[model samples]
Each structure stands twice: as C-alpha cells, then as structure tokens.
Target: MTPADLGRPRTPSAAREQITTDSRTERFRARIKMLGSLSCQLSRASDLDELFRAVYSELAGVLELNAFVLGQYDEANQVVHVVRQVHSGTELPGGSFPVGNGLTSEVIRTRQARLIRQWSIDGPRWQVGYATEAEGFAQPESGVTVPVVSDQRVVGVLSVQSYRAHAYDEDDLLLLEATAEQVSGALRNLRRSERLDSQLQRRVTELETILASMADALLIVDASGRIVSLNRAAREVLCIDDSAILFGKPLSHVQWREWPPAARAVADALEPIIEALGRGEALREVEAELRADGRRVLSFSCAPIHDEAGAPFGGVIVFRDTTGKREMELIKNEVLWMASHDLRTPVTAIKGYTQLLERRLTKGQATPELVANFVGVLRGQSDYLVGLLNLLLDYSRLEAGRFELEPKRIDLVALVNDVVASVQAMSEGYRVTLQTPPVIEGDWDAVRLEQVLHNLLTNAAKYSPAHGLIDVRIEADEQSATVRVADQGVGLAKSELGQVFKRFYRVEGTRRLEGTGLGLYICQRIITASGGRIWAESSGPGHGSEFCFTVPRYSRQIEQRCPRGACCWPSPACWEQVSPRLRSRRAQA
Candidate 1:
C-alpha cells in the first residue's frame, strides 16, 4: 500500500486538530535548532553586521519561512531599513519600511505580534509588499508576528507566514516568543559592549592630553621593559620618529645608548629600583638619569606603577635638563680659581718686600731719611697687599662654606669715625669725613665689618679726583643700621651696575683705577653673611657714587667704656693674646 493509502483518513475536526498539533511541534523543534546554531554564530561574529546577517539567515532557514528581513532603525534618517534579507520566490522591493507606514510599522508602533491567515486580505490591508510576496509563494493562509523586546521597548519584530488556513496556533506563538527573547538579549549585549568601547577610547584621549602638557620628560615602561607611554617632552627630547616602534618595544632599542654619562648613571641606578619593585617592594622618589640622542638630561626621579591589586606593573621616570646650570657652576669655579691666582701673586710679592724692610729697619742699620723712605714704601705696598689678600680670603671662605660670624656689640658712630680717619690718614690727596649716629648695637663679625668699611673707603678715595670730599654716614634704627659711603668719583656706567658685585667683574672705564676687582664682591659676601645686604647707586657716569649696606640690630646693650686712643692693632697675632686687664684699662682710659 502507498504511504497515503495506508494512513487512515480522518474527519475534518480530527485533521484540523492533528495539523495544529504537528505544526506547533515542528515550530518548537525549529526554534530550538535555530537557537543552537545562532549561539555559535553570535560567538564567531566580529561585528554587528555579521551577527545580524547570521541571525537573520539562521532563523529564516530553520523556520522554513517564505521571506525574512532584519531591520535596523536609522535614527539620523528617521527610517527603518532592512540590513539582512532572505526571499524564497518573489524578490523583496528594496526591503525598506517607512515610519508608521506598513504592517512593519503597525507591529513596531503597538510593540505586539500581528498574525494574518490569508495573504489577499492581510497583505493589501497592511500594504506590505514583501510579506504579501512571501505569502503568495508559500500559499500561507495564516501567519503570526512576534515582537523582539529589550530594555522594556520593542527593538524589532520576527514574522512567520503560512499557506494553510488557520495554520498558526497557541504553541506557534509560544515558540516565536522564545526566539524573539534570544534576539533581544543579543541586541542588549551589543549595546553594552559598544558603550564600554566608547568609554575606553575617551579615557585614552584624556590621558594623552594631560601627558602632552608636562614640561619634564616622562616615560612609562611595562613589565617586559618595553616603552608603553611617553609624554610630549620625552618624544621631542628622544627624537622618536615612530610611535608604533616605541610602544611595546624594548626601551634599549630607542636612544638609551646615546644618553650622556650622567643620564646613563641615572638609568643604571633605576634598574635596582625596578628590580626591587619586581620583588614586591614599593619604590618612591628613586632618582635616575637618561641620556637620549647625545644630550645630557638630568632626571630627577623614578617611581613604580601599580596595578589594580597594588602589584608593581612597571616604572615611570621623570627628568629635567640640567646642562645649563651645571655648565654655569663649572665656569664659576674656573673663574674664581683664576682670579685668586692673579690677586695672590701680587699680594705675596708685596708682603715679602715689606717684611724684608721691617726686618732691616728693626736692626737699626739705616739713617732717618732712608728709613723714612723705605718705611713709606713699605706701608704703601703693605696696605695694597693687605687689601688684595683680605678680598681673596673672604671670597675663598665664602666659596668653601667656611665663612662664619663671631657677633659682637659695636658702635656704628665710632666705627665710621675710625674708618674715615684711617682712610684720610692713608692719603693726603682725598678729603674724608664721617657723619655719625651716637650708638648702635649689632651681632656681627667685627673684623669683617671693618674690612668692608675699609674697602669701600679705599675705593672711594682712589676713584675721587684730587681733594674730592668723601662723606661717610652711619644711620641706625631698632631693626637695622645703614652705612653709606658717598664719593665724588667717576660713577659706574649703567651697564656695569648689575655686575658690580660679581667676583672679578669690573667696569671697563675703571681699568686706569687701581683695583683687584674683587673688593666689592667680597664686601657683598661679608655683608650678606652678616645677615645684611649691600647695594650701590649712581646718578650718572662722572657724577659721583654712593654705596650702602644694612646690618641687623643686636637687640642688646653695649658695655660701658671710654673711647680708645687707637683701635687698630699693628698685628692680629699679638693682639689676640694681650692681657685682659691691660686691654680693659686701655679701653676705659
């Protein structure tokens, strides 16, 4: 018997019921198979379009549908258009659905499934050409649409059309609903993944902007000793031509070999810190030097980078350019050495000549005029030599960090008077006078202060024209004391004022004037060391000049004593060990 003959014929109601059960079962099995295949396709899909095409094709093939279309909403264009399509017989016309225009629109608008059993009624009624074409091919007399919903809103619709009358049943609706659920879950996941990707891109852009603005060179290396990130300054300093070559590539391959010795020392020192970090110790304030492209760069620091769990991931190095400052220090040292040598040679010769004269004269071998002449030359050269020696000693002490103060109470008025008198006594050519305040007390190095006053007085005298009046003044207050030495000498040039206190710096116009060029510089150091400051002022060239300095007040009382006949001891070594009783009696009387 044929298969159709062997099967028993059924009544209309029984056939209808049997067909409904079988159709429902078939749809349920098809959806299950579609879900299984689609899951694999979803995992393999690299992009949205690929996933959409796979989902659409798999659903259409498994369901045995007449046509299938996947629509994507064009937010910018305000339209819903098909991205993937499968047609069995008649071709779909451009697969597009306008907003609120067709059966697709009705399903989207209501967010509900719509079923149609007869194509002639459902297709023309809904004005959906693609569905009508599918309906005609399959002779579908009944159909159903299931809305794919995600995030409480309908994203799309999945429609299945049939040829037989009343073909769809409750089971078919349940199976289509399950398929819609899978598609909705995929859409939600796609949206989440896209948002995460966008956020990551924004964070990277923000970090890049911040790094570009830094002044010092900053480089970040990864666990494998490869360059991961570099600031704009690092790129410019190292001459990086390709970003790709730098990132993930070993730092040694870049310009590390060409760095200066100091920079290399910094790099070598950092290796230990990196090693320590690798061993799980946190490194902070680690200093390193990096040399790049033949330039000397002084890097100030290195620090380890930490991961989310506070594990050491890599290191960040920060460095600055110190070439200019280092070079300046070297030049200053060399210049100071040359100046000391030049000044010491002349001073030493004068000291030898004066000592010889002093020895011979003490032996009483010379007549009065000859003794007087030799004594005069000896005094003159001795003073010149002493001035040069004092300046050199003071400057050297400052440089060597050996300068210190032995503070004492002193009379500003008496000191000025003594300094002026001594300066006047040294020469008959220039007239010197002291303008005084009665008293002042200060904690100061008295000898250094005296030397400063003596140097200023000598400069004033030497630069003044014959018989020019040099005025010295002492002004005192609770907070400070100012001593001013005004001379009617050729004033300093405007261009020379700024450099007057620099060691060995002198005005070109003052070459004819006798000086070692260090007197003013030494004076500044001594004044500053004493918690004071000094400055010079001039009206103009050839007008005259005034030099001033202020020393801090001692806030202490001065000891009661009578004016001394002479405060300048002939020799410091002998004076230091004098009897206190005699010294006090001499000071009082």
Candidate 2:
C-alpha cells in the first residue's frame, strides 16, 4: 500500500466491494430522510383522503412513476378496494375487485413484500394481467407489492409498477414496505376520528329530539346567564314566538312588563326563581300562579349545571303547568266548607226543636197541637239532612264509576207532568208550565228521570225572580225523546256554561244560594249512562238559561235486538238513529 492509499482498498475486488458498501450507505440515509418527511406529512393531514394523497406524493419521489395502486383490504368480504390509482403519471378512477391470484392479493395473504422483476415468465405463474392492472393501462414488467400492517394485522396493500423489466430490486421493495407500515398507522387514526365524529353528531340529534318533544318548559343558560337554548314548551310558556330575539341574550333582558297580561304574570312569578338559579342555588317544585286571566298555577325547578371537574358552568330551569291540580284542591276545600255548613244548619234546627219538646214534656205543659207541631218540625229537618246525605252518596257513586241505572218503558209526558207538579208543590212563586207530545214512550229509569227533572226545576226556582215562569218542553222523533227546561233566571256567563256540569262547581253569583252544586253533575251522569246527554245554554248573565237532555227511544223488540258481541246498552243501531247532537255529547262523555 502506498501512503496516499491509506483509505483505499488494497485489491481490485476489495475496491469494488468498498464502493458498493458506500453506495448502499448513502441510499439507506436517503430512505430514512424520506421516511421522516412522510411522517410529518401524515401527521399534518386532516382526514383519510388527505393522508392517502400525502402518502402517494411521498412515494412518488422514491419509486417508478409509471403505475401505482393503493388499496384497502376487506378481510371479511375477501376483496380489495382500490382507493387511489395512477397510470403513466395520470390519476385514474378507483374501483374494487374480489381477491384472486394477483400480486396485490399475494402480498396481503402472506403479509409480506413481493418483488416481481420480470413479467412474461413470473406473471404467467401468478396470473397477473389486465385483471391486476389499472384500467386502460398495459401490464407492467416489474413491480413491488407490500402489505400495510397495524397492530400486527394486515389492513391494506400498496403497489408500484414499471414498464421496464428488472426496475425494482430488494432495496425498492424494502422502501415501499416501510412506507406502507407508516400509512397503516395513519389510516387507523383517521378512521377512529371519523367514527367519533359520527357518534357525536348522532348524540346531538337525539338530544334535540328529546328537547323538542318534552312537555315541560326547559331552558338552558350559559355561565353569564345568557340564554343558550330552549325547548318548544319553554317558548310557549314564555309567549315568545320568535326565539331568535332571546337566544344568546341575558334572561334579565326580557321585557316582562311588555308581555300580555297573563304571560307577564307568569314571567313576574319566575323572576325570583331565575335569580336563585343565577346565584347557583338549586330549587325544586317551587310553585307560582298567574291570576291575570283565569287562575293558573305552575311549578318550577332549577339546578346549576357543572362540567366534569365539578365547576359551575351554567344552569337549567324547568317549568311545569299545575293549574288543574291547584284547581282541584280549591274545589275540594269549597265542597268541604259547603257540606259542613249545610249539615250543621239542619242539625242545629232539629236539636233546638227537640230540646224545647223535652223541656215542655218534663213540665207537663206540652199540648197535643204543640207536640204535633214539634214532631213535624223535627221530621222536616231530618228529611232535609237525609236528602243532603243522599246527594253526597250519589256523587260518591258517580265518582267511583259504580252508579248504575235500571231502564223501563214509560210515558215521557206523564213523567214530566208528575215532576212539574212535585216541584211546584215544594217551591212557591214558580209557575212551571209543560208543553209536550201527548204520547212519547221511551226506555228509561223513571226514578232517575224524575230526580233529574226535580233538580232542574228547583235550580230554576232558586235562581229566578219571584213568580218566574219556567217552561218545560218535550219533543220526540222516531229515534229519541228530548226534554228542555228553560227559566227566566240570573243566567250563567259564557265561561260558566261548560263548567256547570262539573261536581262541586258553582257560579260566582249563585254561591249564596242553597245548593251543594252536585245536582247538575248527578243529572249529567244519569243521562250520560242511559245513552243520553245533557247540556246548558245561555246568552249571558241576566238573559235566562236553558237545560236540555235526550234519551233514546227503543221498543221492547228494539232493546232485545242487540248484536251478539255488543257490550253497549241500546245497540249500535239505536245510537245511530239518535240526533247528531246527542251522539256528539255521548262521545264527549
């Protein structure tokens, strides 16, 4: 060796070997640099398509630029989806194909890299042809195919082909394989992100559906007390038709005083509840009322919403209408008050008369006339008490759905005359005149019918002026009989017409009258259960009122003509024959 040749090979073979080693070292360093560049590109990609495009751009620098195919393997279906394909440096449409004896499938099946150096001989053995080539492209003489693996599983395949034979060597195969492995990790992450995004979108849709369908008013506020969202019911309760004006605005910004009287009343009631929620205090079932229109009661609940860290983020408020419940409670209190007063008055009268009688008898100063008079007074008071108790019993039975009726054939005119005579005998200064058909027979409970008539006549006499004229009119069709009782009395207001049939409900002006408010309710129940209906009508207060009801008219043969499986009383045909008004009322009952 010469002194200048210290770093040079001594033999000819050694010199060639040293040159090859240096070249291989340089190529390895270049491949490592390419890999680093690819990693950076993959990380910057926002989605799967972008990541795949990045992989293709990176691979183009190191491989033959003739043909390329990037495919995702479907293991269950035994197919490969060509997601990206290029031929002669031009992009081609992608497609899918069944797994077969192709270079791509071999790489996927073996999970190994494949290098085909020649086409004519090696391609025939592997059955590689147009089936494996990109559409409108010639078969390649040389190619490298590699499996993309992640978590020790083969997920896809990557291939690059060249028209010239012996284009790809072992080094090219290794480079392609490394690139595929890097792509596998990126593909997995992109798919996972896509799944998460889809799930989050679905959850948002479900939450919106639930909020829209909720019956209670729901309001969501941000940390600064600004309205974030609200449900349909919340908008209705607040009387806000266009919610855009309120969203992102503070709850205090609502000009409650400018709203309609009823809505303003409700908003005023909710002011304190919202204030408490702003203070981060939870409240439940706080009640409020709106008295501007009719009485309406509402319940409110509020809670502070917190993040996973338990720090307060916002609050939610729910409002539920409880008007019906509060009204029921008021009616119950009224009934108890009226019942006590009515019972106590009669009992007090009876007790006073008995005490006087006892004293007079003890002193031997009671005469026959005096004794008889005392007995009569006691009996009248007792009868009143019994009648009151019976009214309560009937109401109880009706409420329990246990009230029953016994139907019998009877003359409608005679029944009305009998009820009118009885009512006139009991109440003075009330002239009740009846205009009816001479003979209209119907299947009905005679006792219950009389009770209904007596209640109507007494109610008319109690509310009418002195010597008021009450007209009882009866009409009949081929199917049913109707009776109408009208009186010149302090008529009910329009709002009170529908409520008059409800138990324990009384008109405001008639509260001072002697009634338990169950007469009309009982009458309604009896008529309704007998396949009939009752209703009240009036122009307005002081214009007089009318009560009308109808009963189906059925002969013995018609009553027995019910269908085999029918459970209803007078057969479907009988009901169909009645007036439309009667059918509508029965349906409502």
Candidate 1, which segments miss by more than 4 Å at Cα? 1-27, 36-47, 72-78, 81-98, 124-145, 159-174, 242-244, 253-273, 288-313, 320-589
lDDT of 1 by residue, 1-589 (tens): 3688567777899879979899868866877887888877776665657766776677566554655555655445557776565565333534565677566677777777776656576652544433353245234456677777877777766776655566666666676677677777776777788788789888888878888898887877777667777887876655554443668865544455455554445445445654654565555444333454354436356677788998878877666667766666866775677566666765666677677777877997667877788767767767666765666676676666555445567776777677777878886788777777677766666787888998899889888899999998888887789999999999987777768888677776887666666788878876765556799999878989999998766512211111221221221223333346546754565
- Residue-level lDDT of model 2, residues 1-589, one tens digit each, is 4789897658988888889999999878888988999999987777856776787887788667578888888889998988878777777777898888777877788887888888776653563444434465466898888899988888898888888899989999889878997889888877788789889889999999998999999988877778888899988887888634787876557775457777777767867876776677899999887788887889999999888997777899899999988877887787688789999988999999999999999999999999999998898899889989989888766655445455667998998898888788777788888898898887777888898988998888888999999999999998888999999999989999999998878888887887888999889877766667899999999989999998777634234544321113233334444445544554554
* Per-model TM against the reference: 0.48, 0.75
What does candidate 2 score in Cα RMSD to the true structure? Answer: 6.6
Candidate 1, 211: how far from true, in Å?
Answer: 2.0
Worst 10 residues of 2 by lDDT: 564-573
Q: How many backbone clashes does every candidate have?
A: 9, 0
RMSD of each: 16.4, 6.6
TM-score of 2: 0.75
Q: Candidate 1 vs. truth: CA RMSD?
A: 16.4
